[model samples]
Target chain A: MSANWRLNVAVLYPELLNLYGDRGNARALERRCQARGIDAEITPVVIGDHWSPDDTDIILVGGGQDREQRRVQSDLHRRGAALRDYIEDDGVVLAVCGGFQLFGQHYRGWDGEIMEGIAIFDAVAAHPGPSIQRCVGNVVAIWEGETVVGFENHGGRTYLNEGQQAFASVVSGFGNNGGDGLEGARRRNAFGTYLHGAVLPKNPRLADRLIALALQRRYGSDAPALSPLDDRAALRAHAEALRAAFSPAESAIGRRFA
Target chain B: MRSLGSGGTALPGLVVERLHDGAAGALAGQLSATALITGTNGKTTSAAMLARILRADDRAVIHNRSGSNLMRGVTASLVEAASLLGTLPRRTTAVFEADEAALSAIAAAAPPSVAVFTNLMRDQLDRYGEIETIARRWTEALGGFPGDATLALNIDDPLIASLESQWSGSSVRYGIEDPDVPPAPEGEIMDAVWDPETQDEFRYTRRYFAQLGRWHTDAGARRPVPQVAADQIDNAEQGVSFTLRFPAGERTLSLPAEGLYSVYNALAAAAAATALGVPPDTICSALESHQAAFGRQEDLLVNQRRVRVLLGKNPSGLNQALRTLQAPGERHHLLILLNDGVADGVDVSWIWDVDWESQAPHCRSVVVGGDRAADMALRLEYAGFPAPRAEVTRDTGEALSRALSGVPEHEQLVILPTYTAMLEVRQRFGRMGASRLWDVA
Candidate 1:
């Protein structure tokens, strides 16, 4: 990595975020870096904001309630070009819940507002309502071999484009449990998920993956190791505790709708 | 871990599921009198106030005193309060703080004799999608009520006032007539106008902040303005107060809460109590004696500093928080705690609509905290305010300490946090304990 490396984390439309505490995402990212002895300078970038895409390393976005999502579409459209440029250069991006939908092709907000997304990851988020699936469980990704436990509350049914596939499969509860079953997208250093409980704190490995991806792009394949030493035992214990507090006996595998 | 079956198994926190599945909807249509106090804002405070009013009348009232209005929360409250046979005790009345969407289900279950619409604002957009949709749902729930049921409506709120036509039952509308309560800020966005003349089938006279300023129109029949028991809603350092107007007479109430909207809330609740056939004295006494519910303009003392809670969920509520901060110039310290969740939907459009760019006092150095802390900070920056003296840390207690310490002992620290963040602030400054409301003093 460069001697003067500063991770630029741009958060989108934080004013409209609701549901689980979304402010946790930015803090979690900051904390992850701090824990690794890395000084991460975070900047808040909003719509109509003019900034150099190269300055940003990690782009973090959060979830919000649906109506707020619709209201923000026009503002987000203003940042369409910059966001596309940031993604094109393999800039690491992280979006959660509503943020995920906002980054994708489009988020069909309630009342059929066709919110034009930045299309960082070719995905269409469909609106689901009347009853939303509140997902809470341990999600073990088969490929990444990393277990992530968090909550997901979205009324959107997402599907990936023809060539795209999900970053991870659900070991439990409707990870892209639609007919298309796209789970979450991780393509070309762009990561998005419906995991809303400050995904980094719950799954530090995922944060490490994003950081590693950013570092690798900046400093070639032989980049300095940036992963925080994993306390798997502690993580496992915490996961078990959360499962105990949230959902137990439900295995890390199921189509259960929390 | 056990199934929700097999002879009433008690899982450590899944009480709501147990009640819903195990009781076979036993709570449905089971109460003698069910009253629901619902709105985006003021539901908890109004419900608590109404509960106090009912309790004053010597009637046993059951409610989620802890502000646990979610499905699990409601069922858990019921389980704790109900008899072993799952039946309410004699002379019982239930005053439920039903969630905006959950209102329909709760109404269907409890079949309330009276439903109060406090007001509607844009909140949890990701969840509810739109204000109109929520308004429609509320109308549906109110319409579902029995013909004889009484609907205590807030006529000042165009959304709530519009529901008058939907209710086939007895309706008593409450609103404020005082023209002095500050006009809706100018430069409001087009969408924020809340135009009553929309081409949409569902339309009403538009007013600012979901508050249309007390109604006097009609639905097929001209209805006189329902007497409001609140006037001269005060929000200065002298403390909040207003007169309670009733058909019998008017008694000025010394309100223990801050904010003009709160006075309107008291007016609405008092009017509702009167509509419910409660005595004027009971309504007047309860309102006079009422204290602020947790985070609903409640005051706290930590290290000899008084911290006031001003929880804002949307542009309307945030505007209220900003507008009500009439304390000009440097002396008063305002601490704002905003998170992504506080915004409640992914939309940041309301940021422009709030007019905080100009409305927020020049001397006020906002302490922004939450998932959207930087967003809030940036907005303030965009609005020409220098960076807040400090961006609050994730630790809400530390943030509170920072804000509280910065303020002089005599001056109050007005805290404006979102729903969950309010709970965090309440837990810190006032020791309200946890989510359970029984222990809060």
Candidate 2:
């Protein structure tokens, strides 16, 4: 990338969808870029704020409570077209948990309330009610030969459309619908997942991948190859998370869900 | 029993709960009055404070002092307090700090005459689901209480204050009314920021921390005036002093605890004490001399160096602890223990929500420890602390030694540990002849 190339990231509804330390994902993105000598700027897009897709290279949306989801539902719908346009232009988007659910076609709550989504990803999430166990625990997934580890805690069982692709296949812990052995949905450069150990600080590879994608979209052929930093802490955390995901004691919750 | 990995604090209660479902209720019924304290944060400190005030009033109190606040823990404490004939003293009062998620079941079993609701914040989402859900459960549970039962509520929290309208019992509402307190910083994790019914963002007139504040919405909703309020909160290195106003009278109390959050705990306790007819002098004196609960600002001397153990289980609690550290403005040596144990919520994601960045510059040195030490180190590294400055040691005991060794002779070492990690620290201290394990009541 050009020496002056900078990445602009827009965080959507941070006031409403900032649950589970999801904002950590944005921080991870910013820090990783700065570590590689790239300038990254994050702008929060809250209610009543106007954001331009032309100035945004990446977008992040985190999870939230059900009421917060409802509170942001209408506002997200208003920004849906612009977000869809940005995605079509190959912009990088990482939507986690509630954000992931809202990136799909629609989400049907257990109480029979349906919240419309932007339809950028061909997926739908449904809550099976409080009677059914929530899909929660340490999760290890395989994404394009990379091992991604995180913590998944959500009550919604998401299913992708017939021709859509999953972001990763679950190695352990319940993901997506829990029965599908799949976690998250992916379309083009847009990604959605329930993994929220901030999902990026531990999975530096995934974070770097997202950053590289955003850089490529902004700088095209002149996009610079990213440099590597000391990831010892990240690697150790990843290993620990992976071990916890496979440990019988920690996996007991997964067993109960099964 | 230790080989089974159980602390033995809640095991007997679990056995009792399994054997006879109504045994806990029976034991609780024997007490003259029972008070159940529940919230996302401050339960232990608040309960301890209230227990002290009750004791100052010469009332015999049975309490779950082990920081195990589950129904099983409550049952266990009651069981231990009962005589072999399965009876408590005629004038005995029970004070139990209950886990927020388990409050419904515990309240159903114990039927407390006084229920204390501390402020609700985002806590242990992996275990408690959400703040709204817990608030809903608490409201529904309080509905099941007797009409004559009294409630001690925090009016600063819109969610907690809203609960009073749905209950039939009288309430003593408590809050901090100090306008001098600074507004909460941007990017701090906040719960109850928006009205669920109106969808309008709640505007804060004065915010202490998280969602504890005097607030109003555009739709005409406003925070209820607290019957018991504190003002002019002075957070000193030794403790916090505040002017407390209540129905009976007002007094300046110098509580032996740190942080504005501790002041909230004191207010909640005083409110509960007021509900129980404890005199103002007795409450102030008890609070001034109150010893903190174990791992909640519990201090000790280890290897000739002063050490303070602060338990931080969630984002809000951790934020408050970090805020306390920043208040002194002097460089601090910190040992932060991050565990993903079941008791610590299994998910360490909440660490990201804590405003560690604000305290990063204030840390002279930091040692990260616990099962998730690497994660905590990574968080600190991202918070602008030099990566090389933070030493990651997975073993809590080894980390404590390293941290203590680095502290100068006159300086103090502060340890911030999660729930299970705090227990581990206490055990290490206990082995080192620094302090006893679970000795605070």
Candidate 3:
């Protein structure tokens, strides 16, 4: 990527949103990009028509209460084509918890109402009471070659697209796929689920992979050689420690998926 | 009759006596029914609002207007409401706010005709332990409700919604549809911090900040459109005007007490009142006229200095109060006193959840008191605060006096205490003949 070209990330509905700390994902993304001389602009857009995929290199969506889910489901549908095209055109979209539900086909709200969603991700989200699973523990994503750490707290069950693959395998704890126990989703350029440790910051390998993908799309065959940032080691250590604290059993077992 | 203590001898004894005598007889006898209003956040406000609405229609509704829902507290209210002759007033309707812990005991004593659950969120962890435990307890108690009983619940709460499958009676749900109340807020530095010890605590995502705003059903549903609105927010005065919309029409309700969460309580109350067939006008008018409950948000005075006591137990409650404070540019003298037991908890690690970096920096010399005053000191030090003239006194009265000493007698002193601490602080100020509790105390 050119040094002059900064990565712009638009976090939609950060205020009127989800139950998990999904914004941590955006902050982590910004911090990672800034370390590599990339300027990241994180702007919050509420329920309005001013949002467009052109201004953003990536889109981040968070979770919220059932009342908020109902409100935003209708509001997002009003945006229609703008959001549809954004996902179809391979916009790097990161949706966490409720945001993930909104991107799917529909959400079966706690009130038993079938709220329409953006349908970018093939999933059906439903409110099934307050599930306090305390999504702690280390998750080793083989694609990243290291332990990817984050927390998950969601009550909806996600049905993945027939042909789509999960974001990661649940080496330790449950994730978006519900009782079957999957970690997240990685379909096209979209990465979505209930993992809210701002997954990118601690899991720099995933952040680097996304950045590499962004470079390949923006610069085609001319992407530059990549190297780890200086503070990457310390950051990884902190992330690993948190994951260890969350997964005392696995820390005891010394389990490594990769 | 089971005796609770010396305090129970007066009224608790009588209520227990009635429960024992009337258990078999009252079941067969014809009399008024009871309504229970519950949840982690809005139990008190909704109960009071519902009571006022029932009373407006010339109904003798008995309620714990003083905001006491514990075993002792409810017993006191019930004993006081019953006649000196030990007979519950005829044509009297019982509307009581129940703590999540006491729901099972209260449920066994008296089965409610209608139960109103506002929403569940993290509040007092040290007391309640886990949010899921509270949810399970509520569900168990709710199971005891008769098949014909009405369930007036917030469809927006995932925890409460789970009860739909268990309840045999008709369930009426409500939500908000205000164009102004944003969907929810995004994650921040605050979101990254988590305490696994208190994992059951519901972390804030986007939507409702500390229990404000209303919810609507997802798109098309058969239920009534539930919307709650806070028409005006007076931070200095600490009150809001809330409006709840039902099938009949919109009921414009006003909460004399402040805090964004109170608005949700008003909605839950209105929903329960509406289900009970209370008139919309009466529901609206009663909410506006109702006064503050004791220790919930009651104000007091120390040496004639006006002190407002706000109950802060969980992250949401503290965040709600912090959000309500005006900028220093608007108002000056505000003293914040937090108890470790009531507000902080034994862990005290969740102090990081309070946007203390913003709130602590803005407040005028906050005084740390209570069981773990030093824990508060540690939190303040980490949040970029200079040594905040700490008063390590365990006595809440001394802390109240010290915190209010600098602030002028005319200006309001914001005393944010824990549950028992608020009671203790209020009792001290009450003896001084300065606490304006119930506007009659």
Candidate 4:
């Protein structure tokens, strides 16, 4: 990237899709980029707002409640074409929990109402019924040899299509669905996960990887090599989260998922 | 009940319920009157305030003072207060705080003559599902109450005020009417901002922390005028003083509890008391003399240093506690505890939503403790607290000692803990010769 290269981060439907401190992921990306001398601009794209994918380097969509998801469904559909084109061009996108479900093919809510997704990842999420317990508690997963830890609370059971890649293998806690050991979905530069300890603040590697990918997409072969900063606190938090996931009490709770 | 041993808050009630199918309803029916307090936050303190008001009015009040707010806890309190023949004394009044999720069941069992609804915020999604689900449950619960039962609702909270539409009973609407109070910062988690009917974003004319404010939408939805409103709120390090306005008259109440949230609790309790026909002087005096519920801004003295325990279970509550810490002029010594136990909502992600960035720099020394202590420390680190200044000690007792020792002689140490962590701290204090958890008023 050029010396004065700047990254524009578009946070989609922040008023509607913000929950469980998921905006921390956007903060993590911006802070980490700024620490490396990259000027990262975060713009919140609410219901009445629009953003051009050509000008935005990274896009973040957080989780929300069922009502909020319903409110944002139409707005997301309106912007679905541009988001799909951005993903196809290797643009970096991180969608979490409810946002993850909305980025898939479609989500069937508890009342059986279907909400169309952007289909960036060929997946479908369905709520079995209100009678079924939500998939909740600490989660530990392995993503490309790195152990990622977070908390997952969702009623929707997501299933990736045949050609879609699983984001990570769940080591503990329910992920995606209790029936499957896999968690999240990844296609090209687009990633989606049910994890929300704001996920990226603890898992710095995943955050930096997204930043690096955004830089590469913005500047191609001339992209500057990403600089590494001290991640002691983040790594310590990551270790603690992993320990919490495997603790005796949490593990017993995890057995309920079985 | 005390003879049953440690952690017996809910067990005795469970046994009584199993013995008699309608034990709760039967016991509550024996009382002269009963008031039920339910909300996401401020249940314990509000109930305590109302109970004190009733006591000041020369009425015998039985309350679940230990903050065991579940259905079983309500039953336990009733059983403990009943005579050997399973009957309550003459003119005995009951004030019980019900868990937000268990309100319907508790209300049905107790059959309250008055109900108090505090503001609702995003809390324990892993346990409560979503804010809307709980709101729906509360609306259905209100339908089951007798038409004569009065509701003391916080009108500032759009969600709680909206509950009035489903109930036919008279309501005493209370809210903060102080326009000078700081507006809610951008990006704060507003759990109830959208108009459910119109799906239009409600515009706030005056916003406070979280979603408590005077709001209106272009489509004509608006907050109702509160009959009991608070204005000229003066928040100090010692306590909060506010002018409590009601239908009869207005009085200035100075509560020993810290934070504007405590003022809300006082307003809620005052509204309930007013509905129950308590005199304004009695309510004001009772509230002013009201002691903080255990771990809800309760204080302790260890050695020569003062230790204040502030309970912070969710994002909004924690933010308010942090704001309270900022009120004191001097830099503070902090012991922050984050637990993931069942009561603490296993998901620790809510910490990130707290406005720690604004408060971290004001602390002189920081020690994090609990099952998820490292997570709290990391949060402080990200919030720009110097790495070397934050010490992580997972044990609550050890962390308290370290934090207290860090404070200079006669200085105050502030401890912010989640539900289970607060219990752990209280247990340690109990062992150190402080009053036992149940012995406190």
Task: Give the residue spans of candidate 2 off by over 4 A.
Answer: A255-258, B1-7, B388-394, B436-441
Q: Which stretches in model 1 have alpha-carbon errors above 4 Å?
A: A1-258, B1-16, B19-30, B83-89, B189-211, B214-224, B227-235, B247-249, B341-352, B362-364, B430-441
Residue B151's lDDT in candidate 1: 84
Q: What is the DockQ of each candidate?
A: 0.04, 0.83, 0.03, 0.81
Q: Each model's TM-score?
A: 0.61, 0.96, 0.57, 0.96
TM-score for candidate 3, residues paired by index: 0.57
Tens-digit lDDT track of model 3 for B137-157: 877887777777888777555
DockQ (0 to 1) for model 3: 0.03
Of 2 and 3, the candidate ahead on TM-score is 2
**Tens digits of per-residue lDDT for model 3, A30-144:** 7667767777788888876577777567888887645566656767887757877866777688787678778888888556778888887777777665443333333444344
Better of 3 and 4 by TM-score: 4
What CA root-mean-square deviation does each model show from the true structure?
Answer: 10.5, 2.9, 11.2, 2.6
lDDT of 4 by residue, B1-441 (tens): 021123348888989989987998888888888899999889989999999999999998999856689988999999999989999988999999999999889989888899999988999888888998898899889878888999999988888888888888789999988889987777776787686756778788888888888888888888899998899999887788999998988899898888789989999999999999998999999999887766788777666677788899998888887788775466778888888888998888998889888886688878888888888887887787755344554678788777777789878888898988888887777666554222343
Each model's number of backbone clashes? 21, 2, 29, 2
> Of models 1 and 3, which has the larger lDDT?
1
Leading candidate by DockQ:
2
Q: For residues B265-300, write the lDDT of model 1, one tens digit per residue.
A: 787678778877898888878877886765676665
Worst 10 residues of 4 chain A by lDDT: A249-258
Over the stretch A1-258, how does candidate 2's per-residue lDDT look in tens digits? Answer: 347768998999898898888888988898888887888999999887876678898899999888888888888888888889888889899999999999999999999989888899899999999899888888989999989999998999999999899999988888898888888999889999999998999999999999999999888898988888999888988988887788778756544235
Chain A TM-scores of all predicted models? 0.83, 0.97, 0.82, 0.97
Q: lDDT at A172 for candidate 2? A: 86
